[model samples]
Target: MYDEIFETVVQITHHDYAGCIDKKGWDHPAYFREQIATRQLNDQSFEALMQDYLRDYQELHMGFRRLEQESQRDVGFTVRRYEDSLYVTSSQQEKRIQVGDRIVALDGETIEQAAKRHARELKASHHEREDWSGVLLDTSEVEVIASSGGGRTLALQAFTKLPHTPSYKIESVEDTLILTMTDFWNHDAITELIRHNEGRFQNAKKLIIDVRTNKGGSDLAYSELLPYLFKGSHVDLRDFGDKAYTLCTERNVDLRVELMDQVLQTIEDEKTRHQIDVMVRELKKNRGNGFVELDLSEIEDNMSFDTKQGPEEVVVLSDVFCGSSGDSFVETVKHSDKVTVIGRPTLGMNDYANVAMMTMEEKFQFWYPTSKSSAVDEGNGMGGVGIQPDVYIPWTPEHLDKDVDLERSMEVLENFTHKGSNI
Candidate 1:
């Protein structure tokens, strides 16, 4: 398992975006290989060890697609890491533990200590990680200290499947419309939502898009919303004037073929199928080429869309949880003169994108980006730092009960809500 993973990281993975790979001088992999060899680990334990090694990259672009067993599961609550302390952002499972509560300890160890083993170890502007306090924790109890004072031992419920959250939600506060998109995964669903509420969107003076928890899917998922949010006629995917540099290896080309097949099987949309067909053909043409530069500056996709009238002004609510296509949406949308990005920076998975998968011996499957961004060499890349918001509203304990991000948006909109009408 170690050997296979090491080869993938060292040989297969393009060492452009993940600065850690070069920073370490590739010594950690060999060290981890030796360390794992000392232990007699089963499949679950093996992947856990590999995951720990993978964490060194600090890139969400790479991960395990399929596992031998359910090696990682979460305690169905949400926590946000502030400095060294872990705060409960949402307490869905433990009613006793409020949103402002601080997680003192998990099992017996301090959150700082437990997070290394239980949660993902990542360093970013806001390092939010999976609350891997075990599937049910060591014991179904967590030591949560109240924000005001005092502490209580609250119970937790772990989940193999996370609690269901809707793809998109639309709300109106007078002329202002709040579109809360949980994720861009539901391409058709998001498209439908936009089409369904066309009148409400067009009539709005201000649009507040909440993508704080969106993990991202196909960039095309939020395509329909682009026209509404965009204030002008044109917006490009290469908002920074960088071409999408896709690495065309045999593996990557094969993965594109696999993706096309999957799309053909599941997707009924003629346009989507045609897009996939085009992508596969392009990849096939560039097979064995080092890095093929795909010019997205003039691409006619929804990403590089021509705008239509809807909301006059737009405000996007983003957090560290948002990444990949979600990050892409924010990056592209921010280019518009009428858009203001609020909340926190994204998870920073845009350094490398268009992720593809590779299975080794049918034991484990590795997921990695098939494309590299031109921003990597340019040095202005949204890799580690992510897309910084214009009006930075630092997330706080008050954010739990009150929609601090939304409130800030409302406040901003109030100052200049009905100044003009054109989108």
Candidate 2:
């Protein structure tokens, strides 16, 4: 019976690649179970069948075709390479093109005609079009809106809404600066803030880094900011496990050693140094010579409160959007005595995901951790189980509209400072 079911699945997957209608929804376990129940397959038979089908599909296509489709759909971008720039267009926008004043489809169909005809069209756009020579332009529903000074703004409300400029706001209540970052990866804004606060660092009694909406981006940015917090100190911030490290050092051991030495120099405290050395030695013994460890101990041990010029206290504000490298930043700072973390728990997707460049296919693919991140606080691994905060602050719909997360964080910082004064 299991063999029969397995054979059936294989037939459905292989024989009907384009029209595998039955197997389309089988990527979901619940849907597959419903189908199995409808077909009246027994538990043992169904389990065996699914196991066989999964293994066979993985061996042949690296993973289930249905799953791959689902993943691609979820990620929502199809990447292409032009001469100079990387092109990433959504599957929903590919059918429509925007001409000067009209939106038309690639097949010379109007935007309305394309939408009415196709059930699901790829949302794609040309990213590297130097000149509009070979590119097709579509313009059907273009509206010209006149500004206050008589300048006309061409608004193209095609598949997506019109792009609006984001509002920059700063709410200063007492000594707290509540900065709400809508986009996590905007380096310009972050750099500007760092520069703006360079003077504040010396004067401010307490500094709060609100990364509530910071989803994560550019690990380099996170690393760069560490110097400001740690000054000249170095500490190992993370370990990428033994196997991964060995692979990293296969090309050069001297580079790895030099890197490790550079990292070790950041540790300012002798006691912390001993702890780091012990951990490194243990890792070396267990994982063998070639693993990379990020040293961030210098920042942890050397943070001084006695300095009249430096920031007296540092607080990190977190939310569900905080993940990946943001989580790493939180974790690294949490180890320090000068920093206190407030607000809700993080998004908990803490594992280091690697991007694989498929040279043969000229594409990039990402492989995230199947195993839980050991670097995180024990048992609080990925898949929605995020890091618990020292203080839990829940956000309501009303709070969101009024921007209450920052308010709550600031209140916490103030209260913490006031309470510490009595002690």
Please name the candidate that would achieve the greatest lDDT relative to the true structure. Answer: 1
Model 1 Cα lDDT, one tens digit per residue, 96-195: 6667778777667775676555444534434443433332344567787888899877777654535457668898887788888878776667778888
Alpha-carbon runs more than 4 Å astray in model 1: 1-10, 14-24, 65-70, 93-98, 105-120, 125-142, 147-149, 152-166, 233-239, 295-305, 361-363, 418-423
* TM-score for predicted model 1 compared with the true structure: 0.85
Q: lDDT per residue, candidate 2, 1-423, as tens digits? A: 434444444443433232123135444344454566577665434543354345322111112221222222221122222332212322334333211112223244433444334311211222211112112223322222121222222322223222323332335557865444444344445555655665665556666677765666434334334544532344444422211122122212332333435546754434444544653443344332333443434433322322224455666778765766566567666765566677766765544232111111112121212112344334334434455666665543244236565566566667768886311
Give the TM-score (vs. native) of candidate 2: 0.44
Query: For residue 368, what is the lDDT in candidate 2?
Result: 16
Model 2 superposed RMSD (Cα):
15.4
Task: Give candidate 2 regions above 4 Å deviation.
Answer: 1-172, 179-196, 227-309, 357-383, 421-423
Per-candidate Cα RMSD to the true structure, in Å, reads 3.9, 15.4
Over the full model, what C-alpha lDDT does candidate 2 score relative to the true structure? 0.41
